[model samples]
Target: MLAHSFMSDEKKQNSPRPLILAVEDHDDNLVLMSYALESLGCRFICQKDSTNTVLVAKEYQPDLILLDILLPTISGIDVVRYLQQDALTCNIPVVAVTALASREDKERILKAGFNAYLSKPYMIEELETVIRRLLCGKIDSTSGFELCKE
Candidate 1:
């Protein structure tokens, strides 16, 4: 289902839902994320290949992005860097979702330009919390959420 076309024009103008760009190579992961985003009343564009992630993101103009750190050919960190450099997509928040759970790995991903990080096998609630925190533009140190430096 293409969630982007699901919303009507009136609904968009009245109460628009946040659009998400989910870049993950795993089909199962894409399905799971799609379900989660749908359940949360958010629209999403999913890309299984990282090769064209930046292009797709620019076209979709998502409010946020859920990026996987490990992808075929291109790493998620590189994708993040590309997005950060592109004026069209630079402002969109990107959260890394990957299996790299080590402290150093997390730090490295953050340093690469991701706005937030979510380790693999993350809880649905945790994902929801992170998504909400980012979409709301509430990146406070006291809010128990870690945000990347500008």
Candidate 2:
């Protein structure tokens, strides 16, 4: 199977893609989430947990961040707070890609300063729409995002 790989390992060696910092803990969820992102024509750097989230964000300087609520070292709330507080990284928009997407969860994360939230088991179009809206400033709200129109 390895020898018959479609791309021929050689081509796979130099795929140049922009990096996005994805902070997720659960392995299965991470795979699913990544699949959706890739399906939407997005590329990223995956961080297993919150421990290296900051360092990676700083170093990698990804186009956007996808964070989980629960992490190993620090909480996702704290991660948002930290990014919002620091002037250098303050402009970066963070989205809560987590299972905690209840009303309170949404309210708290927004209050804590996340640009958006995408509940688990989400669709590719949803991620694409949210990211496009955020990047283009089409959705006008206090968080700099407009609510989805009905």
Off by over 4 Å in 1: 1-15, 137-150
lDDT of 2 at 130: 75
**For this target, which candidate reaches the highest TM-score against the unseen true structure?**
1
Model 2: what TM-score? 0.73
| TM-scores of the candidates in the order shown | 0.81, 0.73
Candidate 2 C-alpha lDDT tens digits along 19-90: 346778787866765665554444666666576667667765666788888876789999988887776678
Write down the lDDT of every candidate, Cα atoms only: 0.79, 0.66
RMSD of 2: 8.8
